[model samples]
Target: MSTVVETILSNHPQAKRDSLIPILQEVQEMEGFISREAIASIGKHLNLPTSKIYGVATFYNQFRFQNVGKYHVMVCRGTACHVKGSAKVLEAVKRELKIEPGTTSRDGLFSLEIVACMGACGLAPVISINGEFHAGVEPDKIKGILNAYRRKESENVK
Candidate 1:
């Protein structure tokens, strides 16, 4: 078993015996997403069926089965934001990140997602990073915003 998987399992041994969903949620939060191996490991540790664990993971949008990047960037594509040029903003972000929506960068520094709405119509063309909203965004601002995240990551690496 991978160290992360072992650590997760060991950290929640009691969780292994019951209620794997919440345990998986906590694991995903720490690891960014769950892997197939993780599901199997969790199943074995908990004595639950893999199918049931997979079902629970699929039932929740909050759970991610694929790997995610260091930063999660979400662009609002709601009607209000659409009218305000969210598409263009999204395009700029894609160009800057060099990855389409629902993809992570090769370096795993960023991932992009498009959401229907964030309920911030007044701040149309909004973008969120790890749930922190940036409102009234312009296409030109995407690079700087991503750069800020990069900068922060670099600082943390030192």
Candidate 2:
């Protein structure tokens, strides 16, 4: 009972069906996503089927199946951003990174996520990398921005 799952379950020693969401959240907080191991452990602890736990998790968008990359790219696609040509910006990013939203690149350099809004509509068509905002982004600017991050990453690795 000293496993990570047991530690998580210990918090809710008397957890019932309603305790599933909280348990999942704690696991995600600890592991960055709802892992297969966590799911199995949770199922065993709760005496519930793995399928049932998975079903509930998949029903929500809060769970992440994979870990985000070093530079997590969050592209805004809200109404303001969309009206400002965010689609083209998103496309440019996809082409540049060769990875779709909710996925990380093979080299572990980047990950993409589509966010509805970043609360900076005035800076529509914006993209944020590692919480740093780039305002008024255009498709043409995609390569330069990515290259900058790539250079920085390489330098950091040195």
Candidate 3:
């Protein structure tokens, strides 16, 4: 992991503090999620503190510290979806996954994200797992949806 970060840092030998986002973006792009070591390497390369680098990363929703799970669950909280019971749906996900938004499940099979919108208003109360939209989501159905992904993983493991 640090090796990848080191290679990325080598590209920005002349990087300034202003280059933080680009560097972080590159890290996230290549590594899927930034690790503490990546932030440390970036800080050393940019002459910034780890706190500053982490703060910057946290400031942007696009950044993630934990490695994303195989199924990245995005729950829509847009106005339309919200009115259609997205909040309950979101809670249901948290309950089922045993992890909240911006977090990956203990099994590393799922990560939850609450997004403002996904442009699927016609299908309000929607959620997208790995970019596959599941519209008209109901709280009771959250477990089945999650279990389906788990089953897929288990099958592949076999």
The candidate scoring highest on TM-score is 3
State the lDDT at 71 in candidate 1.
87
User: Could you give me the TM-score of model 1 versus the true structure?
Assistant: 0.63
Candidate 1 Cα errors over 4 Å, as ranges: 1-65
How do the predictions measure up, each by TM-score? 0.63, 0.86, 0.91
- How many backbone overlaps does candidate 1 show? 0
RMSD per candidate (Å) reads 4.7, 2.1, 1.5
| Steric clash pairs (candidate 1) | none
Residue pairs with backbone overlap in model 3: none
Please say which candidate is ahead in TM-score: 1 or 3.
3
Q: Judged by lDDT, which candidate is best?
A: 3
lDDT of 1: 0.86
Ranking by lDDT: 3, 2, 1
What alpha-carbon RMSD in Å does predicted model 2 have with respect to the real structure?
2.1
Where does model 2 exceed 4 Å of error? 1-3
Weakest lDDT window of 10 consecutive positions for candidate 2: 1-10
lDDT of 1 by residue, 1-158 (tens): 56787787888866644568767887787776888888888988898888999887777656776677878899999999999999999999999999977678999898888899999999998999998999999999999999999999999999
Residue-wise C-alpha lDDT for candidate 2, range 108-157, written one tens digit per residue: 78989899889999999899999999999999999999999999988998
